[model samples]
Target chain A: MNKPLAAIAAFAGLVFLGSGAWMLAGHFRAQDAVLVEIVQDGKVLYTVDLASEEDRSIRIEGADSWNLVTVRGGEIFMEEAGCPDQTCVKMGVLRAENLPIVCLPNKLVIRFADSQEVS
Target chain B: MKLTTRRLTELALLTAAALIIFVIELRIPDLVPIPGVKLGLANIITVYAVFRYKPEETALIVLCRILLGSMFAGRPSAILYSAAGAALCLIGMLAVRRFIPPKWIWLCSVLGAIFHNTGQILAAMVLMKTAVIVSYIPVLLFTGCIAGAFTGLCAQMLVARIDRKPPA
Candidate 1:
């Protein structure tokens, strides 16, 4: 292998190995419970409890758009969205501590937050 | 600029082949829901193009296929992401073309894959208006390696076979 090729191969290998380790750690370790707040245009539109939320669904609407959020077994996700991409809906659910539910067009974010911050 | 009829025909056949693979891959259930975990079966045609066609021709073919493929799949929103990734991947592979021997085609493919992910992440950050999406970068990088390596190896085999056969 040439110098550049070797460098790229090494970089790719590091990325693969690093992510694998992160995922494995995520699997075995317990994640801290956090609160998720959905804000739209500077307003607190929705608040979800990551640890205690029940299997339920909620709808949030914007000027000309809407998204259906579903929480099942304490996990929150976007079941449907009016956006063209539907990326958030396709994302299914927010399980990984590192991965957050996001809708670009709507500027919506559903992520884990520290529970202690509220108290 | 006019392309020979034979070259155009070859391009058409390759385009069709790429689309077929793209559609077939869609039928396969998604193993991950992170919005980017894919085997990228269509990249086989890209790998073939890298070896057989000129860089400009290869780029044109990829652009047409991605646009038409997205429209056919009824996922117009995917155009941005696909186009971004394709452009980056194409450029990266084309640049590496001069250095890497035919045997190291997989290396070029891997580079292309990494750039593809980088482009997608950049687009995601802009669209979502947040750097939070960067967290997914590592996972995408990991998957890109596997998919790139797979497609690269396939392309290497294809090139070897075609090179063995004399011009028809």
Candidate 2:
């Protein structure tokens, strides 16, 4: 009801609503993504054109861990991960543009890249 | 400032309560697979301690909870992120404690949560040697705000109902 409380509430609401919208927008935009980039510790380890790739499993190994990145029918996901948390594995798929499949412990990331020429 | 018997006892009790919450929360399935998003239900005690106790005492309570909580959760590797977030959250909450009125406990908690997420991401960046972790900050911020509000409200109610004035 007061000024400070109202201001706090407005700020919180703006962040909550605005980011949610942005994330959702990103999700829809990713549906059109055809290039998936694999980066490790900030370097582009590999880039695959999802539209052209046949069903295959790529095993990515880091310092002391590994992630079995699988591509099936043009959809990419972390089918298996050696990290303790398995967060990236549980992430299911790389379907969102902004929300990358990040295995923090392994310094691994699978994200939708800009090249969208899916044939 | 003096660590009287009653004060020591209260701090211990609060730390124990927070550890319990932390352990219980560790059992809850992650709502999202995002690294930084969680209920963070244990933060309820930190928020309550920030308002009810002195800064020094609050720090002790948070330190004990984080250390013990990590042990109980069986994630020793998590101690770094948890400690960084708790330190930042405690400092920010203590600094802002003077301005925020009792009714805006949720706001204070929200700020704490933002700082917590920032610290976690920063730690990740340094430890992982990659800026890609920054991508999670927005989602963490948004989720942190909601979770903070819930825990803060719970703390606010608990603070109001149970009256224990600190010694002057």
**In terms of lDDT, which candidate is strongest?**
2
The native-contact fraction of candidate 2 is 0.48
How high is the lDDT of residue A56 in model 1?
85
> Which has the greatest DockQ?
2
Docking quality class, candidate 1: acceptable
lDDT per residue (tens digit) for residues B1-168 in model 1 = 468898789888889999999988878777665676688889988987887888777887898899999888776657787888889999888877777778888877877898898888887777656666677787788888888989988888888888743222
Query: Best candidate per TM-score, number?
Result: 2
Estimate the TM-score for candidate 1: 0.85
**DockQ of candidate 1?**
0.46
Report DockQ per prediction, comma-separated.
Answer: 0.46, 0.49
Q: Estimate the lDDT of model 1.
A: 0.77
Model 2 chain A weakest lDDT span, ten residues long: A22-31
**lDDT of candidates 1 onward, in order:** 0.77, 0.82
